[model samples]
Target chain A: MTIASEPADGYAVRSRILNFLKYGANSNPADPRVPFYRHPIFVRVAHWTNVIVLTVMLMSGLQIFNAHSALYWGYQSDFNHPLLSMVAMQNDDGSLKGVTQIGPWQFDTTGWLGASQVNGQWAVRGFPAWATIPGPQWLALGRLWHFFFAWLFVANGAIFASLAVYRGHFRRDLKPKVSDITGLPAEIAHHAKLQFPKGEAAKTYNGIQRLTYFTVIFIIGPLIVLTGLTMSPTLDSAFPFLPWLFGGRQSARTIHFLCAFSFVLFFIVHIVMVVLSGTWNNVRAMITGTYEIEQAGGRHG
Target chain B: MADGATRRGFLMRSFAGVATLALAGCDSISQQPWLDPLLRSAEALTMRVQRLFAGNHALAQEFTKADIAPMFRANGTLDPGTQEYRAHAQKNFADWRITVSGLVEHPLSLSMDQLRKLPARTQITRHDCVEGWSCIGEWTGAPLAHILALAQPKDEARYAVFYCADPMSDSNGDGINDSDFYYESLDMVEATHPQTLLAYKLNGQDLDIAHGAPVRVRAERQLGYKQPKYVKDIVLVDSLDKISGGRGGYWEDQGYNWWGGI
Candidate 1:
């Protein structure tokens, strides 16, 4: 909610903070741009917390994955017939080389995937040192980081979902309407041409944005959590149907890995869109809960 | 135009620099004293949550004969290379005795034959390693509960600490790992599990050195590390503080979560 009767100094301080962040000259004081309330306080907090939690979960997860450095399907790991594996082999000259095998096909991926430089020495590892949490071959610390943040991540997601539903944030912003489906083609066309919505339409997300957010939050979120739980032995004993639902334990692990990469993919696209659309406007909205809705210019379709 | 390109290059370089700086900061922060306990608190949460749901009586999944892997991969210390272990192995573990003492009324020093004569349990169960691999094998051994019942653990007995024959290298001189023998512990719930056994056989055959021959523990619900190989002693202790590293297990001493269910 906007405090319409706010003191003059509040806007001045916010403006000063923005000026320090921005490199270019300040916007004209004579013609002030009206601010539109976009993200709520809850959304802002949840969003920022996720940025930290997700990063730790991903990096530490890679460290954990490095322990086995292989993926399989079905109940147990078929060591000989792994779906994917990272192995180190000695060459003819006695030089160690890293090879990644994916179901009969093998590729030399030294210095990155299968093996990488660690502490100025060529070490056999799945992911590079830079990618993992501890920057070393420490499974224990990695696990600690993962499990700790995993709880936080789940808690954040639960809170965000409950709040979104309770506050009508879902219905008002995220939930797709009949028009969202009907206008999908036009939205896709606009996105393809790098033409974001302008004027009244720019006040809220387009059909594409709504659909993507909906899928990521509702569908992908639950799927990842379920798949993660399926890997636990005690959980499997407690809920036998979990692994059964995902085919098996190993299959669940494979799906969990896929879901992690899906988030990465979404993150890449999300960042590109934020940068392309209006970096300052979007970032400032998340930070201060208000957006400067752009006007229809000559470039607007 | 040149200025725009230069500025773009500088921005990209600075981004990479920032990322490196952030990673370095993360690494340093991970070593902080407060952060470790903060992260480890999740271990307690996970253990409590899992145990609450899966009760003590719940059994780990059992497999059929077909599910057993052709070769159950042997990991960690495959051999207890000490002279005592070598001599014991030479006689097919005839001289080998499992000393079950501490926090018990009837302390036991049972030979292999005596342990074999006790209540035996055979089941095909999956051995899940902490490194993320699983192998199904039919294990035959004396149920730990049957032995615990005979020994009659004292009221203060809170954990069944396992002492193995395998000696680990104590390189770091961390007094906790100085008693280099690989060891693990289980709570009363896990210790008393029907499937928990002092496994003396794998696939209907006597345990070989490669597989913790003489005996190894088979705590089916826990990860492989929790099931220490090369059994030598079984000590019942109330608190883990007096033991090596005081974390309960050798790997736990190395900063692993003591709760291995996950």
Candidate 2:
């Protein structure tokens, strides 16, 4: 039942090339179309909700980070020895420079980190104004934006995870198989050549995609949430073990920052992959839950 | 391969354009009337959840002396700087007095000497600032519960507000020292918590002017902003509705969430 088994008439490779060339606004193949229901209605809703929630959370989180502009690694800040810090350093005689320090190393990150132009004048800030929520150095509003979205993010994640587990989506789609691990090198080669699974193979996520989603969902996602909770004073009082697990609150802050940036990195790669693979098809799948595969849904190995 | 790469570049640029537009749309709607309260709902949720879990009695982590920072940052106002405050500081705060009034059964004015004689508690704890930094130091003072006991807050009292000497803004056009001063408040539950203190000493010494001299609050389970400094009075009230700007604290009035737990 595999595509190769029915190679004679399952899919016309000639029509596939022509269809890709046509590349209409709607990526619905005209004839011999395999409308694969890749994403369910629930998944589509959760995915889009997260798209908004995570964006607001990241932007507002940056605003909050700009307030302190330094990262320490203990119960309290040493002030002298920070893991990382963004500060406005003044050159001899005049002018301000944004210097970002990572341990012993320092970089002049002017117009961006540490010092940046705010309202047309040079100002000291951790991240640039464009990157933060509310577009100003307003800690109060930044906090409001952050905490508000944080609630949505957590609730959405909780609901998504519960449903994912209950409906066996985690097991059926996200979980990797022994063949996936064994085919790692070959899959890497194929992906390196910008070749994606086509025809029947496009029914589910590839091994690398499955692994990435799994790590992000189960590992990084929970770590970020836990580190965030550790920063709360009242929560610290209730769950003393939170700080202990993270080494300390300051360490948690550093890790939280790192995890945030990790999400950014993941997002970049995700977008690139989507664009490179098939922008309209991938987007349409997420949006409308109907993904047009190369061939008819015969049988997936 | 060249054609595919070219198409990818275009798609990437298009995605970036869409993302930028979305962000701009969000920024524009941030201050809209319809959405402001919706955003504030999280603050209430966080306060309710944290209070539910921690409750009133749970003590913030009490660290050993070794955990204390070498030099605790004296955040917020360094000194009140008003002529009256200057005179009080010059006199070693000997004549300075803190009044307890508002919803209290007995309004009383007590001097620093009398406050020092009240039931005292000392602990080394971390001070978490709203700006994402922390410092640890030892604080010695009368437990706020004992102070409330002496004042005998009335039955309707719900909040204990700490009024400080630090002037936050120049409200008066005359522009001298007549301005709304720094203030903070805690729920009666937090006020009665054993760790909540009207601290007057840091690291076994009288507090320096930079560190809210004469007196300050140590609401151990809350962020630094919840603990006002340079104390002058304690007002017990049933509601925070009538306070300056009416949001509970100075920062709270400035759009910071009233709940300082997180």
The best candidate in terms of DockQ: 2
Please provide, for model 1 over B1-262, each residue's C-alpha lDDT reduced to its tens digit, 9 standing for 90 to 100.
Answer: 9999999999999999988878575788888899998998889899999999889988888889999899899999877787778899899999888988999999999999999999799999888888888888999999999999999999999999999988888557763223378999999999999999999999999999999989999998898999999888999999999899999999999998889899
lDDT of each: 0.86, 0.87
Model 2 segments more than 4 A misplaced: A1-33, A177-182, A295-301, B1-25, B171-178
**Can you write out model 2's per-residue Cα lDDT over B1-262, one digit (the tens) per residue?**
9999999999999999998877675567876887778888888789999999998888899999999999999888887888889999999999989899999888989899999999889999999999999999999999989888988998999999889999977666675555789888999999999999989999999999998889999998899999999989999999999998898999998888889998
Cα lDDT of model 2 by residue, A127-217, tens digit: 9888889778888888888888888888888988888888888887788788778988999998888767767677878998888888888
Clashes (candidate 1) = 1
DockQ of 1: 0.60
Give the clashing residue pairs of candidate 2, or none. Answer: none
lDDT by residue (A62-91, candidate 1, tens digit) is: 999999999999888888899999988888
Candidate 1 regions with alpha-carbon error over 4 angstroms = A1-34, A177-183, A296-301, B1-23, B170-179
Which CAPRI quality tier does the interface of model 1 achieve? medium
